[model samples]
Target: MQSQQLWTVRWLNAIGDVDREQWDKLALPLSTPLLEWQWLHDLEASGSISPRYGWQPYHLTLWDHEELIGAAPFYLKSHSGGEFVFDHWLAQLASEYGIDYYPKLVGMSPATPSVGYRFLMAEGVDKQVLFRNMLSAIDNSCQQQQLSGCHFNFIDELWFAQFPAHDFASWKHQSYLWKNQDFEVFEDYLQTFKSSQRRNIIRERRSMSKQGITIRPLNGQEIGTDMAALMYRYYLNTNERFGPWAARFLNGDFFTRLFQNYRHRLLIIAAYTDSAAPPIALSMLLVKDGHLIGRYWGAETQVKDLHFNMCFYAPIEWAINNNIKTFDPGAGSPHKIARGFRAVANTSLHRLYDPRLKILFEQIIDQANDMESANIKALNQQLPFAKNTRPV
Candidate 1:
């Protein structure tokens, strides 16, 4: 590891503290849209992830003399809400050991469960050296602040591989992902499924036509402020249906800002009663580099098969047409399985400052990981695809 004195580490309360160009230099190269400067800044500016909501931004950045070299988007979290990786059990374990779990350091794009997190580094720097120094900075900062040890969730596989050397324990989770297998068309995709599932999908799609509903995907130049506002209403309506269990993290302002500033990355699938009327259902997605992430969706009224149409079938068809390689329908819903989403492993890394809690984590983490792995395997086995057609 290089000497820590070679780099100066500073913590900022907001992403706006850094220049947009400088931040994007590192972020723009990433595959996921959530890590981009505009997304993180809007999350903070929109009050969706403020300190009052238990997410206090404490982003760590590194510099070498006058050059901005590396940074990790971090937070001082007071509770576990918004983070898809469930760690409430960890909090309970801390309580059992008479330790405090709140106010721990976390690193990820807020509220986003997709991976692709790592220290952003400039060219010509030894990545390992910079990573080691950054890890030191995180450790020192956590100790100085008397916070629980840090966690990096949904991290890129390359970065995840590096953490074990630094003693961060790995925790496994799962998410549904649809991977394109050189499919030339939507029908080609259906062919991979069993004959029964293929017929079922056809029936579900036929329902849209029977109900006189049309789904349209609008992107880039097609998105407008009015459409963005309508999408926000659908987003809210979806959450309201769930009542208190809704993870209504983003607000109307965030939606407005997203459409205004980042519409190029947005894809809205609008389901209308017909071409003459407004959309009754909408699903908002982010697309970049042949990957699509289904973020939010809602419907003003419950239409039979509307959720499946707007959320899965329509998006998958559009993704196939656009040559998208992957579609990550954001967390939850076993229904995605029958529709072709496969349960894939997702991981998070952790380190606890309390020795007793750390020991407890070590003792139980392997068993927990085993259970999750088995669950994923079992879920995949139940998928509607033919055994030979399943991903290896």
Candidate 2:
């Protein structure tokens, strides 16, 4: 009989500790740019995600002797602000039952709501076996550390399907997603909308031109230092303007580092009034493969319809022109439906260490998921697409 090879499991406190090439070898094959080595490294190196802000990097890596084979980016989070899955209700439920909820282990790209989170396994490996071993490690860690639970947010559908649901409860959440329907041009996109809304979109776009504001994409290398600095300023100002509700998890340093090192995945949609004037508004997005994910945006000056244009319309147009397949225009804003983005169900998996909490979650999860599914259906029914051109 052949002896089984034992996998070496290592808990890393920082992603930077891993060689960039090795990390990218696993991450680059994935559809999401947010999970790439440099992106996570910038979040840590910039101090944007750190213990001071309630996010402590606690990545899980598996080694096959001298070779790197598998990894999962995780955070020991003290609060649930940036996860975007909104488990405060669960926390509150746990509190009612005398369960501690903070200091939970979270798996996701910090502050990013884009989906497709999964363990990065090397090629030619038994992925199911790797997943089982990784889960065992995580369960043991949670018990050893007295953590309340482990939560994986915005999981990819493929991963979700094969996920061992016996170990964790599935929670459904909805996000605004726009899928390309093979429209060749921007106007072709508008044609998908109902007549009235189509006219409204045209008016909203033309309103910017009438205001002497031109929106353009500054992709990859075009996002130089000055524009990056401007973006950081706008991000800060935008967060401050939102008062207590702001999701201001990132800092100026994060933007600076990303612009310097991760420009290849960045796209900035900027609005300008004149040839020499600085951009009045800007929205930043991450592009990887055929997926476009909206991240942050801010404006130095208020302009009519600038928010809709810079954040949605112009980006959608650019996505079409660049042959991008899908767009997740960040989070919130139910108004995205009127502009053609449909509400799609996104998932998060949860496992509570306490037996009582686990029972409670299991008891209510099915009903909760059904309600959420119904909510997604209700939201999508409100899409402004023409009756004859329903989105598939």
Candidate 3:
């Protein structure tokens, strides 16, 4: 057995440096699917995130003798492109203060916006002590390398409470989340909406039938390589339509690997002209621990309310059938409000090494959080649910 004083921190350039069993020993117990070894490894192996693309894997692992006790999936980010927490404004502020913000240490599941990012520690370990040690290691590395600071995005709310003791400040943001309030069926979900909005949802779902498109939910062994390839095409088409605003981080290879290795956690909602034909539209969701996360979706042809059907209604219905407790429809799209997704606060934590920058952020962060809270409150009010209706 090694002494606690002998704990060592090693920064890895690739996740493959650590054994998959060791990594999953920490990751498999997590509630979020994004942190699992298969997901992270696929992102790196597929070249979706690499130094050339501005995401350099710099994972941190803690060791005691031969025991791998803790790990944090980290990155040396050259630019903040896929990170959903908008920090371009902070980068500009750093520039004004003569700080080089690029290549900062970021801790999160790459390209995923849902929370549950925390340092993975072994069971029965002193988490607080380990957390402090990990933070110290990160701070030492940041200062030694002259990186601006470290940021942890979309942190697990429970773990987030532990950060203040370590001097990390919180930034508040909002995302749409659909909570299942013991809903047994799709109609039970619709009952939460007001009469007009409920009718609108029904009409939107019916539009798929009117266009001769049938939405099919396929999972597990049903998702084959060919279907995965088609989904990737739709993903690219969706991103291409947005041009500069596109967040197309994954490649075709990533989808192929995802289908092959991680299909058990995959749920594809496909819209086809008929059972004999290929899908014209597709929406992909990642499921784990009774939670469903909307990952990607796109349509080859234009159909009225097709996006709504594929992305929202179809997925929600499937989630209900599968007993999924919550559905995070991913980020952006105010239209999600009318579809029964409520505005929920998501948080990111920050710690700047420079005192000047830290002081500046402290001064403004509370006001920013307050404004965000107000926005969340206002948005929830606009949700097209009846006054007495609880979230479903």
Candidate 4:
């Protein structure tokens, strides 16, 4: 056996240029992010999504002599804001410590935070070997560029056991999900809730229905370019009203192209006024395989319980109807619990290059994990249901 120089990293603006069959073969199991070829290509083709906007595509590939053994969806980020796990504080602290933090390296499924970000390895290749070599390459890239630290956000379980050796930082980010365990219907799932909470849900839906707020679920093909702009407008309006920090990672054209190509994997639940010709509030979700993930939502005008109804309940109800295995109602909201979205732990591993910072973050992570675990336990105990009531 000849030990040849193997594994290299190459960036592709469009997956179209890559060998589609081979890439998808490895991409499928490496992450649970999404399986939409057209959507990702849309992001690249749009040009709005680039290092120009603080996100530069950096795809890491591992080769054995002459063959492709692994690949990771990565980026060179100018800031750490959009990953959904707040590292602005870390960036601030880094500045105080006189460390360059911006323009850092990232290993993630750019703009999406649904976990499962790691290098995709081809069959017959030992994953551990690929990870080690890939880390060395990543370190080399960072060092040559003299950039700050690297982050693997919302990482996959496979990377957790291996990332430590690579000196990556491990951060515990907050994520919650609702699971379906043979739940036959929405009603069956509702039975797990307390009577009061169940009644509240019933009332929210009934109120929306009474006000002629009916929801329509659309896919990529069903969603047109106009709706894409409308969605972005609403997204911006909501962001403005809420906070500047609530801004989305993508632009209008990205959504338009996304719906055009990857409609099969999309599940958009739009809320329309009964008497109106079209939707007034739009909620977009991604349905790939057996999982339903709520991504974004916005309304032109605020309606009573509109956010909860459109964002959480409607999409979740659809997930139940569609027999989805899990529902991630995007980012955060304690109100998710009131709507039956339960607390669940998500793993995010990191590697800090600086030894002193590493020691400090290690201690912080220990406390953070403990706090998260206890909080989850408390959340479960505080379920609106009576103490004697058993979850279905």
Model 1, TM vs. native: 0.96
Flag regions of model 4 displaced more than 4 Å: 1-6, 11-19, 29-37, 64-67, 162-167, 220-226, 274-276, 386-392
- Considering summed lDDT, which 10 consecutive residues are worst modelled in model 2? 1-10
Off by over 4 Å in 2: 1-4, 163-166
The sequence of per-residue lDDT tens digits that candidate 1 reaches over residues 147-256 is 87799889887755764577889899988899998888999899999999999999999999899888999998898767768888888888898898898888888888
Instruction: List, residue by residue over 1-392, the lDDT tens digit for candidate 3.
Output: 35569998999999988889988999888889888889999999999988889999999999987788989999999999899989898889989989888889999999999888999988877888888889889999999998888999999978757656877888999999999888899999999889999999998888878878888999999987688789899999999988999999999999998989999889999888878878898899999989999999988967899989888898899989989999999987799999989999999989888888888889999999999999999998899888889644
Model 1, residue 264: C-alpha shift (Å) = 1.3
Model 2, 107-158: lDDT tens digits are 9999999898988988877877778878988999999999999999998867
Cα-lDDT of candidate 3: 0.89
Judging by TM-score, tell me the better candidate of 3 and 4. Answer: 3
Q: Write model 4 residue lDDT over 138-178, tens digit each, in one string.
A: 78887788777778777766556764566555556567787
Each candidate's number of clashing pairs is: 0, 0, 0, 11
Write down the lDDT of every candidate, Cα atoms only: 0.88, 0.89, 0.89, 0.72
RMSD versus native structure for model 1: 1.8
Q: TM per model?
A: 0.96, 0.97, 0.97, 0.89
| Better candidate by TM-score, 2 or 4 | 2
